[model samples]
Target chain A: MKAKIGWTTNRLHSFAGITISLVALFCIPLLGSSYYDFLFSLALIYSMWALGYNFLLGYTGLLSFGHGAFFGLGAYTVAILVTKFSFKPFLPVIGIAVLATAFLGAVIGYLCVRYTEVYFALLTLAFSMFFYALVFKLYYWTGGSDGIGIRPPDLFGLRFSAIEYPAHYYYITLAFFLISVYIGWRIVNSPFGKALQAIRDNPLKAEAIGIPVRRYKWYAFIISTAYSGLAGALYAPLFGHVVPDLFHFLFAGEVLFATLLGGYTIFLGPIVGGIVFTVAKRYITAVTIYWPLVLGALLVAVTLFFPQGIVGTTYSLLRRKIGIKGGE
Target chain B: MLSGVIRPTHGKIYFMNKDITGLSPHKIVKMGVTRGFQLLCICSNLTTLDNVRIAILSHMGRIGRVFSPIDRDREAYEKALETLKTFGLDKKRNLLARDLPHGDKKLLDVAMAFALEPKLILLDEPTSGVSTSEKGKIMGTIEKVIREKGITALIVEHDMDVVFSYSDRILVMHEGRLIADGKPEEIKSDKKIESILLGVG
Candidate 1:
């Protein structure tokens, strides 16, 4: 009987998530104007990046401030591929971008995985700054502070560029976002996920039990970076441009905030947080240039009272109420 | 054979014949060495079964292979069940590790270490906070593992009775230095051991 309930609950959870995702994907194209559709695609892109960050922060309990380096590396791959090689197929370029970013992540993860908590974070941040400096100094390839622009190409065999519509780009972005979320879900449910969480709870205990905690961490970091790179690759085509800002500290902070605001525990939290952030930024920026002040105040309020973030707080409250009744 | 946790410096260690002197704690663990904390380190949100299952999964070939129910098949379940039964915790397998009593948490932590099947397992204060009656049970479990599995165990414990009961050999530390080493009976009667215990040496 209990097993039946567990099965039912699992089914319900999967069904609800799928339903919501489908609704959101379909509704965005219908409800929004062309400009809003563009903004929505950007939000999906950012959410993909934030989800990757959460894989490290939420699961492994390792806070990284250099995820932007991976994101920029991906964008740089796309820019370099398009400009230098005139890469015909988008799939191969994105694949290369993922591989390059994963390699970079492995190197950075190897160096920083030894540090604990705050030191790990600081090491990653230092790595990010190093990359940022390298990119800026080598102006010839990176195009320095000005950034580079690339025209969207035909996706696979489809004449996606021929349509040249925001809606078409929205669908592409949505497909990528869905795939990224699915991959993230797979990682989070796997034995690797269990090991990652074990490390987070207690690294020393985890190791003593014969878990190679450092190796698992490096794998997590590389996987997260690969997802971030995939997101950035999608962003390049969606925006028709790639900029140094993708590598900036502020951009990394934005991804962090998105992860927090959405609630790290729930897979959908980062996506919701990204959408909210993008919408809030758009609406608030139109109203006043001092939007950061307003957002900062809101963030402070959220932090102090709803420390678990929106989705997390709601889930806890619901669990308490229902769980108590169920126990009775 | 289990490698010794050789301290090269303060807060730094070498494990399994590797210079893990400045390596991250996680990296040190990945090299097949881990220490059980005095406090419970199980994921508070997960069940005892899940916690042990996580340990078993530490050696999994790939992260992508963990999703299927087949990943946690009869073998993994049996192993987890066996570990729990050995610790007298099979009945409470479904309970969250956090919901366990202090003594049980200590045992569960050790069980988690055991699940990893490490060549060398380090237990820091394993008998600390355990009741007198519970101490025997915990010690029995550790001894069973060492004897039956031939797994090397390094237990840094404060309970003289528990330590002396299970240890094949003993090393006494004073002011972070190895003060004495011999058979348990010899160490128990040594002047240096007495002085260290009585604070007279």
Candidate 2:
């Protein structure tokens, strides 16, 4: 336990940091670079996805290589609702997607949460691939390999024109991103979150001390996949497309890579990683066809030198050098 | 077997008037049969107080509260402090459990189980890894806690001295079959028990 810091020091420090970050995010689209706004919106979506992933990676200590299934599940649900079913409401479509993905997450998590390490990761991978196969085979409903296009649904009857939709969508994604961060922060600081960490540190010990290790892992799995679903739904209109590749293991690896790059342990690590990785990948691909090689090398470098990822290492260094208040 | 770590092949497990046979470890613990392992198994990264607070929180049914911050739970904090104080570990509550000395680590493990408010605690070699000089003090603290709380303690120990000193009744098992069940004095005076455990045949 840290020496009890003053209320002003503890609360004000994190509060001010959050305010500044939120303000910066709220104003990203106003920079007059429409292209930058588009990239930032994509980055924001991935950030939310990575934030979900962190629940498993950072707190619950489950390494899932199949979260792309939830993200893809979300994207396809919204795409199907819009294109096939002709659903028009924004919130309800996302709501249904969240509920559906959470349902699937619950089933899969119940099975996978009982295992750990490679077994847990592999089990999640199997389920994700199973989901990918399901969507790919149902060509009439899911568009199969042809994928599906998304028509931006009405936002409470105030529909934006094509020219302004991108800018408006940025704000919407930012709003959800802010909410996700706040809730994520709150959940991690809660007793449930501490219990998850305890399970991660020592499941046998956690069980002996009365923490239901497997059940809590399942809970974390549901929470994370729901967030993934939400991120995927939010991403549909932004990308204007849903594809089966989103559910593939490779895409899951990308999400995992971004999370590790940003700093999975620190609260905001995955968010930063998501933003940087998405934006960096876009630029890197445009620059070279050898993008995979470059990215793979970066992943290796980060894993070797910065195991805590970028934010975690920097937070520790700052705390050590200047004794700055990073966080608990 | 009583804590439901493994199923008992031959008998039922009735804890506090409930059939808790083959229940999950957490459910068994929730029913008031908490356990401590032979090895130190506290959540080592967390502070000593937080480790105890987690058990207290579980006992209080606050482990599932997602909205409330862990540190703000006054009842859990105070109760955890009380459990720590019982083992004389409150002074080192600020330190991480893994960083504690060997004896204190053993003490903290039992303290966490105590925090769960177990009606019956099953301790496996509670003083196993501690120095011989500190073993008596650790056992004394644990004995005091069990006595004060009126907890039915089932301590598994291999130390002859600890067994002779602490036990009221003794059961001797040879080759996985119970050979003796009686008061410690009776077991001490039994020729069969002396032949088996004491190797005085």
Candidate 3:
């Protein structure tokens, strides 16, 4: 219901803003080093996942710690199809990935959304760890901790290898990222999005107003996981490997951290947060083996000083400086 | 228990000749019964119109439409607009719920309940924090809307004057028990009810 800025002057500003950034993304592969392009592609993938994560954490106010399971499932689906069967079709693979995770998400979300706050978080964590163990311990089909490998295949019958693949995949990642953002924008601007925000703001009130809060959450969970799965599917080809680590709770924590860092309330926060995190992690790991310590310290700083998150704080400051009259 | 916000330890709830005991709040709403909170429960981040629009969307089961723009649901949007107009909130439709005054916030809460178009509504302290001068007006608006829509309501209020004036039938509670249930006149004349309400035992 924070619809004051939607599709108005605020909407046009954001539309133009995202368009400019996306246009910049189109130039990254042509202008930047392959390493930079690869890293940017990875950031884009993370943005997709973070956007999905925001649906629960930001919009619906349900914090999940098990989304890595969906991510892993997506990776595993692509890995299984491409490696085991040598499947080449890209769209079907994405479809399978989304469907698989949505099924899993629905089952898990049904159980988890019955609780709120810490209970919900713990439940999602428990379920995610369950998947981590499932993939880790299942040595036969999953190849144990070794995971499975994938290759950059012909996308819609247009083949590209090592040198050409980065650009091709970058474009692919960009396309999907744009699609995901468009879908998310449409969703949050819709009445469904309003209801989810309402539930986030006040679950009791949402229920009294006839929102089937749990059911809405279940649907949100499925949609969110489907997006995570799409990101995961994209991730597998980008890295050319699908490991059990993808399922690990640690990866789930990373997704959570990125969303939090970005400011969950702001529309573009997670995407910007993902890029920042990717850049920061890259530089930090190069200099120190204790990257976690550096990252943790940074997180603490952000929490202490910028609780609205990077994008959210920046937006608020900009609005205040410009004298725009609206509460975030 | 009837609205299913709370479960009775040792009793069954029936609505429209069906047992609704232990049904969830949503199920109760689906059965055409709804409730409003004692506190300001409207979504603070949304516009006044959006607060009601969300209720309408939930009622229509269109909250699952992820692809279509909600504004494109022009019929529903216009209906919500009309609803806001009825509540005199149309002029402030674009304003966020949190920005509304205390009296208006309370009105928005009632507006959301009305959006559900329920057969019956349970209002918990509908006028709790409004200024003394505005309480009657708020209640008046609610009663007028409810009567106009032909909806039944069970309101929990502490103000005896408002209760006597507004309610067609009355139920009084004391120490977690129903002390009296009857016409307002009958309640005023009852000795035990008088003793408890007026401290004139």
Candidate 4:
């Protein structure tokens, strides 16, 4: 009986917590500066990306070091469509980008997910670098490292100038980000999510329980990479360009680091991590020329002290005190 | 040999008159055979109930549900509860599996295998970590549940008393070769068993 109170209150507190974040997110446009819109837009995109990526790593127990390939693929597809073919309107481009990434992700994930630990990581890394090299070498089409500049697509025939793009794009990103969160929540609390978590916990046992472990991991990998593609699709118009650098292994590492920083165990941990990484990286670079050094030091500190990441550690501490537990 | 965790070098395993040789563990499980490890294999971080619930959900072909909240699946939870009630772990259903005592962890491991509702259950040291006093109780429960469900149990046990008391038939193997196969009383009186296994002349 007493435990029920604790669980209910914990659920209420959890509900309150996510609601507060949504409220904060919904009001960003009210601040209204182009810079605020742009910065928060990137943060929201990254958060959505991390949430999607976490399905493969956090829930499904597959560590992918090649996700940047899909992200870049999405961006490149959108950029090429807009810049070369003069593809108008926002929605179809993103849909196409998502499809492109999902199609490729399904291929790559099938081969990669069956391998555990280091083998899986290396194979994904290899695939990502291959994509990076392909774009880099195909200078004419991809525009190489110089990249292709992107013009904002018309929003269903409502043309918006570059000056007005940031604010409008921020709102679009916010909507998609909210949708991603809801979808992520639905997934993690579902039976499919339970099997993925079980696979993460014990593959042998999961299989013994009649779960097709390999197939489920592959599904998660496809879903995760598809998310990266969506984030990339959103990113290109905001940044006004797409580059082969987006597929670099370093970029994949950064995404992984950010997710870990927020704590992969909690559902919102990666979002927090993504937001913190984007905002902090910008400020840190502005403060010092050796920003990589600062970020590296921060990573070391976080790894040593807050290994569970911010939300994970805080949630656990809260649970310890209040008899609350389970994934946030 | 049955659930295909390890491939048999030279023999076929027939379950319900189907060729199940070298099939994947999940495939074998799908064919109505479940195996529990001697080493506890339950998801340690999840609640005790959830540990069993995974098997029940999988058995019910609900593991692929993407839009449904598992917590809202009252039927799954009820089934999980019933499985726990059989193993006497229902009271600790909310506690994390890792927090369970060694004996209870073993119980959870076996409990998960049984949750599959398989036609045959292969238990590898199901009571190895259990306390002396609790061993008989757990074995009694295991027997009762298996009998009630009409599932055949193939148990690998080091405890001679448990082997003697529980098994209707006994197969004695020495160095990968079957030496004796008979009813418990028949095997107990075999000369090779008397000389080699029991260390009695």
Candidate 5:
């Protein structure tokens, strides 16, 4: 048996990750213009969202087609707080948004966790669409299909809106992204995360051991929703608008696609995948309208050939080449 | 006393203080109870270590923060390894349970059950199809695990010799109704047990 504690390969990997992240943080601004900075921030935001989705789908082995509901709820909460209530400090607003979404997630997750696989996916999708319809019908609160326009707030009396710089907003987005990434990392590395993977692998055996599988799964779903909601909340300021499109199934599909592209086994895979996806969407949409078709084809190819996903497959190849075996 | 696998109706069972009477097989497993299937319920895709790890993880309190250290993971891994070692599976830890020979998989399944550390471990036909040479080793492992781990094990076995050898007490079920309960030697001499096994009672 491997020793419990040591300066193992995992430690080395963590060091490598930190070095790369620090280098990227310093280099991105130097090498690219403000436009690239903005796109990079957007990529980071989507990566967080996709990572959240991967938590439920990949780790817990539960498929949800309605996470857009949580995303939309977060966006709406932030929009309402900032636009109508005139909330100034971003932290409290973001906190309230996460809390509200977590509560919503708890309710939906309670209902959906009872089911598995396709049925669970369908249930979440139904609930999401139900909320979507409710938002559409409640025109006074939601502003109907047109969505509510949001203006960036002054952070501690420092007005980014007055400055009118994309770089300023990019920094704000980066802050949110980093925080969300850290929280997500903490969640996936926790003991709870291991239990969720066990549930995915063999739920029955999990229960027999005294782990409350349903409760754990419900908590997983809620956390995933809360994280996705945080992403949506950050998004309101990033785009300067909150729309019903945030709640659409298409948005959920995009996150799912990103998850598949990244591979859930490696923690950083989705982030890399999200960057690739955003760049592809940006460059492809500029030239062609049928971008979904192209993206769908690419996803199919990835699914068919690299089923373990880009990160998982690459990690396996690297491990084989390096003659490193077992968990890292 | 630990809860028995209570059958409230046909095609239904209640185990480990849960009303699993109408729950799906998987749901029943999720509820802190399970019956070892006739064919071992090991994941064919993963190694024996992975299988036991999954089983240990299934009973964890928090499923969301799985990658984080929870104080239980190390303990679980240690316990699982111990169970595997008890079953002589420590050497084959990296090998997939499915790829193992039938006898080894059976031993692995029992070890996997031990990894669950269940309050009541159910073993269905535990010694079935074992080679005569290996039956003693398998039975010895099962007996040792129950004693060492303090687990209440309920073994359902058709092999009369194996059953007679290890059971401190025996419960003979014929057509779902328990027909006898006594020490193994007492059960061996019972006319009812003989009649039931002969299909004439």
Candidate 6:
């Protein structure tokens, strides 16, 4: 038996890096303004969404172009429950949102997983567009394109005014984001995650080895969308409204962009990518009206050059600098 | 057709008294029929140990246990280790599948099938791309494991020596038609098989 190389020098380096970043994250609200707090929370929410996306795209090798539907589903579920039914507590709202999105994921993933590669991507986009149309046309329930506004949720009867709400919600989003990341880490390192990676690496081999590939993909899809739904549920309160645009393909593209920018192969890639993209998008748009053009050019350059992604490229360079060959 | 990667146009496949024709590859695998690919199709990005562990996880129905760490499951990890040792790949357990030589990759493929603990395994090419010297050793290891596990194997091989030595029965196909099926000695001596297989009468 091979001696378990449980924590090698490379893993240790990453662990240290993660620790420092986490510590810095804990200090962000104290050191920054309310605007910075708001932006950081938004980034954390997107990071949560991208983490789930990576499970499919990065780990399972399934490119879904309609995850916005799941995101919108969660936001809509929360909006309708709070507005229509006057659901006050945050826990049950998130719970219902997750379950509802999982159901949607099940239905969509059922049809979508039957196809792979571009076909799978297109199918997801179709479903997302379908949801966007539903939200846009059904003005009575969904409020059409105007969307539904949400009040800050009470936690066990503790409520805050508008001034205190963003910071309170910032902490909440940060907490959920950390929990989601930890859960995602546990998941990807588990036997389940390895099987997904195996399926990603070689579908033929995974199937021949008695893995129910479609079933696993379906499971991954549901899990991923569940996380996205959770992110949306949290996001609705933070943003003060849920809009039909949440279901738009453009939003899905941004999520995909974040995953790609972070390097989906690494566990922490999406988090870094989400934070960086949010910050960059905010700053770029402020500087010029041609922000989309600038973002598009940068994306093209990254895709053409740093294909492995920011985390992947940096790790490779670091390994090379130390004269260490890659791989276990 | 049997392993369900492809469907036969005209016939049904019966395994363990059930018809499994046109079933998906994974469904066929669940019915105790699995395969090793002609190409080295082990997960190249993962370690040799992880490659086998994936198969074991699938077999044990623990691939859905997302909350639990694989390392915490000592039985599964040990079983994967033992499977690798069975194929003489335990020493290279930490090495990624892409880094292993052709022969070891072939053995890892077979080892992956063994992890499934299937009743029947279809080996596409057990010794393809392996060096001449390493062929016998790899084949011997695979043959020994198959015997020990009491699993039936249907191997597709063009090497006459390997076919004659490793197989109890033989099958020959020409233009997708079964031209011959018999004991190795009978097929070896047959004029039709000799002309088709050896290119000589």
The TM-score leader among the candidates is 4
A151-175: candidate 6 lDDT, tens digit per residue: 8677778795324656776787888
**Candidate 2 residues B1-201, lDDT tens each?**
888778888888786688898999999888898888898788876778888998999988889998777878888888988888888999988776777998988888899899998898999999897788898999999898899999999888888788888887787777778888888899889986787776732
Off by over 4 Å in 3: A1-7, A162-164, A325-328
| DockQ of predicted model 1 | 0.36
TM-score of 6: 0.93
Candidate 5 chain B: worst-modelled 10 consecutive residues by lDDT: B1-10
Ranking by DockQ: 4, 6, 3, 2, 5, 1
Instruction: Report, for every candidate in turn, its global Cα lDDT versus the true structure.
Output: 0.75, 0.86, 0.84, 0.86, 0.73, 0.86
lDDT of 3 by residue, A1-328 (tens): 1223454656666566766886898899888588877888889888889989899999899888898989999889888888778887888887887888888888898898899999999989899899899898988778888888777656678775535568877888889998988888788777778788889998888888777788888888888999899999888888888889888778888888888788888767888888788877888999999999998998888879887788888778877897555443
Q: Per-residue lDDT for A222-305 in model 1, tens only?
A: 988998898888788877778887787767887887788877756566767777777777788889989899878877887788
Give candidate 4's TM-score.
0.95
Worst 10 residues of 4 chain A by lDDT: A1-10
- Each model's DockQ score: 0.36, 0.63, 0.67, 0.72, 0.37, 0.69
Listing candidates in order, what is each one's chain A TM-score?
Answer: 0.91, 0.95, 0.94, 0.95, 0.92, 0.95
Candidate 6 RMSD to the real structure: 2.9
Q: What TM-score does structure 5 among the candidates reach?
A: 0.84
- Candidate 1 stretches with Cα past 4 Å from truth are A1-8, A161-164, A324-328, B1-35, B43-46, B59-74, B91-96, B117-122, B131-137, B140-154, B163-196, B199-201
lDDT of 6 by residue, B35-151 (tens): 888877889888899999988888888877888877788888999999999999999997879889888999999899989899998998888888889999999998999999999
Compared with the true structure, what per-residue lDDT tens digits does model 2 show for residues A38-116?
Answer: 8898899999999999999988889998999999999988999989899979899999999999998999999899899
TM-score leaderboard ranking: 4, 6, 3, 2, 5, 1
Of the candidates numbered 3 and 5, which has the greater lDDT value?
3
Is 1 or 4 the stronger prediction by lDDT? Answer: 4
Kindly report the docking quality category of candidate 5.
acceptable
- Every model's TM-score: 0.83, 0.92, 0.93, 0.95, 0.84, 0.93
- Highest DockQ: which candidate? 4
